[model samples]
Target: MGTRQTAIRRGTNLPRMGDFNESVVLDAIRRVPGGLSRVELAESTGLSAQTVSNICRRLLDHGLALETGKKSFGSGKPRTLLRVNAEARFAVGVHLDPAVITYVVLDLLGNVVAHLRVPTPPVADPEQTLSGLSESIRQLIEESGVPADRLLGLGIAAPGPVDVAAGLVVDPPELEGWGRVPLRDYLAEETGLPVVMDKDVIAAAIAERWAGAAAHSGNFLFFYLGTGSGMGLVVEDTVLRGVSGNAGEVGGLGAACTTRGMVDEAIHLGVLSHDFTPIGPRDAERSLAELCRLAAEGNATAGDIIDRQAVRVGRGVCAAATLVDAELIVFGGPIWPHVADRFLRIVPALVEKSPFVKSLHPTRVTSTEVGDDVGAVGAACLVLDRTLSAQPQSLLLA
Candidate 1:
């Protein structure tokens, strides 16, 4: 589990304003696995030695940092090396997909300490669904044995389009009866912790950048294949959320790649019996799994249908990669594991052959190292990122 150092912002030595500078030093230390001495932290963060020492002292006193050991450079006395206390703080993330809801608890290091999955409640009452979701989160935290006092906050990864500023889940296509639900505020009230929300694809991309396959990649695209499908764009090490925080919608590309759409196609083509027609999101997933099974068992028509789908996905991703000049493309979501083998065989070659991708820079295509639970892990990372990671924007005066 490698972690990439985020965009660098120099620390200021100004008096009575060490919060931003402290975050800068902590961020620098967390990025290095072996740990850093106060001297090394000051050199890397461009903060004065005194400022670094003060920040380190605060961190140690708060139990957020630890003196791992001593490292000697040359003949001088050994300098104490500081490393992050990974268990000192934790975050909880919940991913609300159309067919399932995922819950995860992550430590400061973005490791999933506990997780649980439940089928999305079929009841049309949004209040009931929310109550169930809150209970699940409570149970997960209690079962994990994480102290409530040390919990940082909660993060939600819901289907878009979300009202980010207002903290609402606004009329997502698949989440029926959820019209402008105040999900963030509701969860925050129930859990008694600050909550942050983002689109599912965006959160998944962040998870990859934080602890998964794309850790080393500043420029990449994460294609999320789930009950629905979409893309998450990372450019120059920043997750791109447009003015409305809905940048990942892929238009018809998303529709064409949806599990329902594919299952319907199979039924229409007579490859699957009309009995397999999906009546709901979960049914659609079951049908898609059967279709994949058929293809794996050498059913020619089933194989053809899946292959054609792979082509559409490949073309869409290639076009997107070229547009973003992305050097890496990662695939993951709840549904990814089922189709990974087939998609990987087809997608990588398409990328390699894309004229724009080949001419400018080599693009690598692969599956997410965070496994199928990436959305949930990513949701947790949202809290970790906000609470622990140093953001240059935090320096801006309100």
Candidate 2:
């Protein structure tokens, strides 16, 4: 039998040859708030005037951009200002947490048009959970009033060690039935739209650079603390996608923080055991709530747990900084708000005490300022960034 080849479609775009030029122009216009004139676009992109004008005409015709107004300076002619038409396109972002699911619809401007959250289906049944997710997406589209035809695609942020090359989620015990699942295939078919997937933290890092606090931060790290620890990196203004798309799975770094009769692993407070039961599975969501409740009541055990986990997280940050020299480090995930504020304070202290990082320079550590929607918003930004952001790496192709 002939081999069945599957093609992953990441939305549609211009042919490869000319897309490079179009992408460059689009990126420049997106960066400028007041928009740029033909001359300005040509100057910024290093394209000839005729080329910029041609590309501009194409973008405007496609509704990706519009003539906002005209500008004049000195003896220069009043040049027509062009700006991106944010409403021209939209993207759907879904964050598939083990305990909770978050969905958001974003216009081209990275604004959340609408968002909703619901309890995630049990991980034991992939088909049923995915069906529920698909229906939720349809409901979102209907409620948000976003034209389905204008959607770029659906982007999913999930726990990783994902085989992104083939769109498979690998061995996430948190997602019980997701062992090597062809998630993109199932979701794309279910939702009737193209799908892109990445680790939740990685998506959060992209969101910051696209629309959050780190819009201008090119080299930074995002430390994700939710059900557990995860990390994402940005080097030279691009999110690092390492082999298998799981470059920053540093949760194991907390091994040193494990306690006996807990995870048989790290002693960090993130290890959630019901009724002090050792070796039993933990409910991360309930653990989070419990930890917060106890900590608020001045429970030293819960407070100490958070501190120890932050130390491990800081050590991981030091490792990344020494290896790649990240300039900024941002923290996000549901866990941050609950216990990581104390974690955040302790992280910097630990980092400063480290000989490696202190010898080079102190890496800036901060929590995400994007609110509770960091993961979901990042997922939406992933679609926009992949489709429109300037992708210089494509030049490596023949």
Candidate 3:
């Protein structure tokens, strides 16, 4: 194959020689919210005026940016103002859960142009779910009137213990009976697009970093509080996937809390059910919610149970913060609303007293706005980011 053909096959979007300069220019434009004129772009990019003009012309011709207005000052010639045309490109996000499957179509600006939610397809056959997912995506694309070329790709956020590097999902506790499924390859084949797979919690963290609570900050933790709790860590804008890609499994940490006599306290407080069936973070949230409702109605049993659960959760958070050295912690998933108030009031104290954290140092804890769609949105953003920047590390489609 020729060099251009070879580059395309390799999935490298830019030619080797001038890719850095092109990326720098694009990033500069992205940073400028209202976009920059040619002259202003020159100043911001540190390129010569002629170079900026050339780049702007090329970008405009490529439809990456649009001329929106004209700016004139000091009676000089009016310069055309530019802005990112988010609709120029698009991405799709899928959140696959045991109970529901959510699909969202997002433009480059992270705006949802379309969305679909339905009961999860039967897992006994596996193909049933995949086919349903494919049909749903096709319906969304057809209804949206978005061209096939503009459809960047799809992102899948699934239950965890995923081998992200291999694009496979291992045996997930909640999603039992699904043996190491080739989710990335299957979804890509079904949609005729590239599909990226990630743990639900990790994807939520990515969405928060891009469009929600942690939009500007780094070194934060995203706790996806569901039937199971999953954690995603971000250090300096990159999601930290540990050696095994299972970095933030906090359920195991509860065993450590047992040493502190918190387990019995949890059961006694009714935050944990006396029922022997295995429970997870979602169960904790459910218990907390029940307690909160009772507390709202002036039930002492509910109030005390919630208070005890808050302490246990705080212990876990403090442990994670100390180990990861996270500067901020964000909570999302089903349990957040139930425990947000209690967590906000109690976690700080527990973290402050912990030996792991530095004396007098504070870790900012907050709730996430992305909610359940965090995974889907983050997945879409993942593809879009790769498409725009063409970075080797952030591959969206295979």
Which candidate number has the best lDDT?
A: 1
Q: On residues 216-320, what C-alpha lDDT tens digit does candidate 3 reach at each position?
A: 465788877655667888875567878877677777646422212333344566654666123443344444455567676876765665566667777777777
How do these models rank on TM-score, best leading?
1, 2, 3
**How much does candidate 2 score in TM-score?**
0.83
Better of 2 and 3 by TM-score: 2
The clash count for each model shown is 0, 7, 2
Backbone clashes in model 2, listed as residue pairs: 257-266, 257-267, 257-268, 258-266, 258-267, 259-266, 259-267
Where does candidate 1 stray beyond 4 Å?
1-17, 72-79, 358-360
Which stretches of candidate 3 lie above 4 Å from their native place? 1-17, 20-28, 36-55, 70-81, 121-123, 255-291, 322-325, 348-362, 389-398
Worst 10 residues of 3 by lDDT: 1-10
- Model 1's alpha-carbon lDDT is 0.87
Minimum summed lDDT over a 10-residue window in model 1 is located at: 1-10
Best by TM-score: 1
Q: Each candidate's root-mean-square deviation in Å? A: 2.4, 7.7, 7.4
Model 3 score (lDDT): 0.69
Name the lDDT value of residue 335 in candidate 3.
Answer: 53
> Candidate 1's residue-wise lDDT over 173-277, tens digit each?
777788999999999999898999999999999999777888768799999999888899999777899999998887767565788878888888888999898
